[model samples]
Target: MLRKNILLYFLYIVSSIILLFGLGYTKNWENKDIIVGFIFLGCYIFGTKYRFTSIILLVTFSVLSFYFPTGIIYGKPTEAILISLIQTNKLEVIGYLMAIKYEIFLSVLFIIIQFLIYQITKKEKNKFKYFTIFAFIFLYIVSLFGISVNHHGINRNAFLKNSIDSWKVIRKQKEEQRINLGDSSAIKIDGKIDNNDDTEIRVVIIGESVRRDYMSVYGYPNNTTPFLNSAKGIFIDGLVSAGPNTQLSLTRTLFKAIPTENKIHWGINVVSLANKAGYETYWISNQGANGWGDDVFYNLSKLATQNKFLKAGDFNSGNNDDEEMLPILEKIINSNAKEKVIFMHMIGSHEPVCSRIGNFTPNFKLHNEAGCYAATIEKLDLFIEKITKILKGKKYKLMYFSDHGLSVEKTEVFHNNNIVEEYEVPLFYLDSDIKEQIHIKKKISGLNLLDIFSSFINIKSNVTDSNYNFHQASKITDNSDPIIYWDEYRPFSTIQKKQPPIKDIQSNIIGDTVKLENNYKFSKECVSYVDSVDVAFPLNKEVYKIYGWAAADKDKKPLDEAIGVFIMKNNQIYFIQGDKQARNGVRDHFNISPGERDDYGIVSFVDKKYVDSIKNTYLGYKDQYNQYHICIRNNQF
Candidate 1:
């Protein structure tokens, strides 16, 4: 009887664990399902003859369920089930729903174990079965730890870590303020009140992945940025980056806490600071509104006199064009308002670079990386020009910068190839006739954009102690002394500073940028480089960092693995290796110039085999870093 009951208890544990694993697959977890499963198991285990063993099994299963991933713990099971059921047929829905029922059925099986345990171990207190209960506890802890370790940024543990750190910083700042002032704590970041200028407006356009490297207005080969080049404003060159990802880059850009001296991860956002300054704050975005302080942004927008927080699409599958967002802009500009800071967050050249615009093939003559990017930039440029023209007489000072630079290619993964082109971004400030009246002071970087709000407003206010909220704008373009972060596998700032001139010329020549039906000129250097490493190249560097490409290589041939070279000329990124330069070279793909050979180089052609073979090599550091290094043969080419 005791043996039968123990077996039944063990079976229950196994079934519950299987259910837990299946539930975790949804990526979103529901607490209610676990509870239901637990209740069913408890009911079944009560029938076991070894009553103590049955009770212990029931408790262990219940406790283990609580250790579900954060998302599962926070999410609603019913809602998840309903969502999963959407668009499914009756039979499919029944099958899916049947799985949930089976979880309960397995729990009932525990009752058979309890009956047997009671019959066999009736004379005993069931001391041996307690070990299994302890095992469950240990397994729960180990399993959770393993899950957290495997998943870096998105883990509940990591999010909690950041949140707790932010709260601690906020508390410490509050204490410091009290010590400084007995009566009241003044806003530290915000300066003295200036009543001199009543009518002031600022338009901040935050571009997504708009690097200066490919901008025609900035002297690229193509005429991508014709509008910006002709426009009237001060074009600031040599803008540097604080980090790569959007959350880190945007947090540094918006929060006031100085990111130059130390890294600030958690702080009150600049939007809140702007609100306290009595200026109308508005956030118009072309992306999801809920990521890192989205709640804070929403709250600030609500406090403002006018709030227009438009999400271009839904949380999951809804798709909206960036250009289509112009309708909302037209309304905001035409509306009645005074002293407003309008933040326009554009999806300016974000990838699936091809899907940014509706038409896959807008122009027949246009094809290739530069051309595709040029098309997108041209579209955005036209939009900007139109917006500037509309705000003709409006009192506004416009500051435009990208969240972070994106590697020019879609297939190119960040962090996989640590290159300057992946990190370098564009920064520009355009002041309309109205903004000229208020003289701007202090040298500002996008890194300090969030922290400098009080300074931007030129008013009195409280500054939050949270560094996460403070924009690390001051570090923008501070390449002389570059700041490194987790995502950057190896330091890349040095690459931007060093490298020879011959590499620069070699990088400039365009390779097979676009292989259209029409003929296009292929650079001689690109052809020669691809030919040399087509079959054999000796590996000199086991692991290395890629800088930039001399040119782009779009050739559809597999080339031998070669070390990617990095060089900076006139403060922009360029790549070259030995006598050959990468024409369509992608940093994420071992800086391999685009082309073909038996042995594919760093950047290979995407196909069924390529997609199927894809796998992550290195482990990410803290805070969700995907950047990695590569093994390269360097002695021969």
Candidate 2:
């Protein structure tokens, strides 16, 4: 019996070590992770009483810890996971279970092993049970203090506790605020609301998780927003959100929160203010009715004369797409309300990007998350067309803006507050009468939305500051004020300090031109490549044109072989490659000429008259692996 017990104990220790180390390897094996795994194994083997209850708890903990790293990689932290579990219905839970079927299988295998150990040790008595209990208590205390060996920011115990605490605080605050909205006098607007035109109808379309950089209307390579691009609207460039997340951003955007203010007065939101001003305010949302501080949104919507939450239930109810709100929106537009302010909240481009499209075919063929995201945007463009067509020929003006943007880095699409892309959203004003398009290049914050709305409705508010109103006479651009964002809600500079400053090419142009000598030294790289290169020169200023190109060598096939363009100006050599090779479209600023050997092409600069002259200029050279060519001619090649 003693020998059998010893064998069982050995098997348990071996199994524990294997499980712990396997989990560590999933997160990329660092020395720290291996050490952490060994420590965890020691704790599991020595710190637990050999009873069925203790064994079950230890087994569950081990399985969860093993899967935790994988969960975090997919942006599902403990907090998010708990929130999802709470908000999801049985059907949604089933769907999630289906998605992670393999994980469940692995968990079951671990559970079976744990059950065997528990069964085998049921009759055995643990002599050192007191010491085991004390060790467990010590481990718990250490874990609570966030002392762990793994260094990839995956602190299991502390992470779980923090997530629980954060969610609890958020929920409590939202609930308390919702309860306080019963008093009408709690929210008061000290302003005179005057509407010069009674027939005018204004619409505020609130988009969700949409990045401006992804939209073709905002100069993206893909035509994701064809309708918005052609539509006569005033596109405001560089409009960043106050927060990367919806709850934080929308709270600031809809309320008159000053730049210095931390708290958001829920009762004093745009809907409440519009209600106070005697406008028939309507809130139409396609997002879920509850979860993720959405109860606060519901409470705020109570201020509106008519409100409809199409996608009712918690976060797991799934998004119904932006078009789902269109039918109700049409009904509201055709209603008897004369001077109305309808707020349409859309579930635009929220992640899992593929689910946003529903059954609709994607517009682009990128065939990834980006393609799905682009497809969703295209669907939104179509939805915009539908809304605009319904309100055509009326004295209606529509203002569209996203609550916050999403961060897409490589294959990962997430909400990262640290990155600027997560806050950069598109804001545009589409008026029925305005035919010509207007583009505003100034940087603005979504926090100034209340003031912009006030200006739109022609309301003079004593409580609201209109210093940043683009429509009013007191329009000002204030870059000195910091743009506050993130979960902690910290402030960051409005100007992108990391990016290189764009030097004005016109300002740097010298009056006297330096002519190039005909003594050119061509590198004998390749023997058989020729292409027509186009170069343009300024008619007023004489500038030297340098052209360089290289094609792949058939014989040598060297990897280091490359083609580059070198321009010598003001005793400084500047090299430029194609726009595709440049980072953030900053090719013109490099000191050394950049090159591209793949599509060995031409690079030149010219004025309007000289553009035509350099269109057909041809010059040839050779390099190590590719044939090179230089051209200096014009005429719109």
Clashes of 2: 21
494-519: candidate 1 lDDT, tens digit per residue: 43522111112112222111112222
Poorest lDDT segment (10 consecutive residues) of candidate 2 = 582-591
Top TM-score prediction, candidate number: 2
Off by over 4 Å in 2: 1-45, 56-60, 63-125, 128-131, 141-164, 182-187, 192-199, 255-262, 291-293, 312-321, 358-366, 407-419, 433-435, 472-474, 478-484, 492-637
lDDT of each: 0.42, 0.56
Q: Which ten residues in a row have the lowest lDDT in candidate 1?
A: 613-622
Encode model 2's per-residue lDDT on 1-637: one tens digit a residue: 8887686666566555444432434333455444444544555565435664456445555555545323422332333444444433332333344334323333444555555666666666777667677666665443333363656443343434555675786576567576655444554455544445454578999988788887778787767788888888788887878775676677778865655555665555677667777789999987667754576677778778888998668656654667778889888888885789999988778765556776666454432345556677888888888999989877888888998766552222445544667777888888887787777776777777877776666565665664545453225564444466543445556424221111121231211222334433443443222222332221223333333333323332212333334344444323332211111111111111223222233333322232222223333332464343333322211
Q: For every model shown, what is its TM-score relative to the native structure?
A: 0.48, 0.61
Off by over 4 Å in 1: 1-200, 257-267, 291-304, 312-317, 359-364, 410-417, 434-446, 451-479, 487-637
